[model samples]
Target: MTHATGYAALSAESPMAPFTFERRALRADDVRLDIRYCGVCHFDLHQARDDWHNSVCPCVPGHEIIGTVTEVGPDVTRFQIGDLAAIGCMVDSCMACPECVRGPEQYCVKRSTPTYNGKDRMDGSPTYGGYSDHIVAREQFVLKLPEGLDPERAAPLLCAGITTWSPLRHWKVGPGSRVAVAGLGGLGHMGVKLAVGLGAEVTVVTTSPAKSADALALGAH
Candidate 1:
């Protein structure tokens, strides 16, 4: 086990505080990364507050993670030391399942192993997230961070970018498509950017008209 430190919520109502825990030793086919940035997802707050009633105590919440590979287990081949990588909402999944075979490991029939607040498939250890300084995950779940992208700005893309892109892509939004994004917050702003990038005429519907300028700046119609 490896010692790790991060801020965690000891209970549903407790504010996050410095907490110490242990991470499992690397296994074959594993990649260990030194976390550079971890995006704050809405779900992180939900879990930290036990909103869904499934949170584990001393919960460390973060999923939109960006990092550089520091070590690789013997059998790992897709990455090596010094490579930039990322892990989204999932750490593992049963690849043979229907949801995984078709596409979207996030919908794995057996339930994808979440980056945090979930149990490891093998040893059943509580999965800790990227709120810590480091994380270890199977090579399959770790994605390569593309070159030329700003690592800081790109951190949110792991979650926000994909969350919007997937739906638009699945629906086949294109040049003539009409898209309307509600709200101008994190996810909604990304929705506008992606929809417009795909050539859709995007309309951002927000409660405050003051956000109109920001929406247009993000490329919404």
Candidate 2:
């Protein structure tokens, strides 16, 4: 077990406060990371506040995480100590399901294990999250941070960035494609940036005219 410290909500009405806990011991396929940055996703807020009515007490909420690899289990091969790494909302899934085999682990026949406010598939222990000093995740769920990317800025890419990037890629948005983003919030701004990068003509549709400059600066039309 590894001692970890982070902020946690003790109850639905409680604000997050400093809490100490233990991270599970390394499993053969697990990777340990020294967390460097964690992006605040609104989902984290919902979970912390028990807005979904299912949040467990001592909820440590964060998912968009960037860290430096500090250790890897014996069977791990994808990362090495000192490598920049990340973890998204998912930590594990049943790997034999058709959905998992095809790469969409989120749809695993057995529900995917969330980063926090979830139970560990192996021991049913409550899972904590990335708003901490470090974390342990299965090798399969860890991501390699690209060499030149800024780790601090890349944290949100695990959540908001990929959330938008997936649909854009699925639709094959590219040169000559017209993409209209509906809002200029976290996800929308990321969508605009990604679509523009994919060579699409991007447009921002928002009720707030005050955000026009912000939208255009993000490469929207």
For candidate 2, write residues 159-206 as lDDT tens digits: 999999999999999999999999999999999999999999999999
Please, what is the whole-model Cα lDDT of each candidate in the order they appear?
0.91, 0.95
Instruction: Give a tens-digit lDDT track for model 1, residues 85-156.
Output: 999988999989988998778889899999999999999999989899999998999999888988888888
Residue 101 of candidate 2: its Cα lDDT? Answer: 98
Point out where model 1 deviates above 4 Å: none
Task: Point out the worst 10-residue segment of candidate 2 by lDDT.
Answer: 7-16
TM-scores, all models, native as reference: 0.96, 0.99
Residue 50 alpha-carbon offset, candidate 1, angstroms: 0.8
Worst 10 residues of 1 by lDDT: 149-158
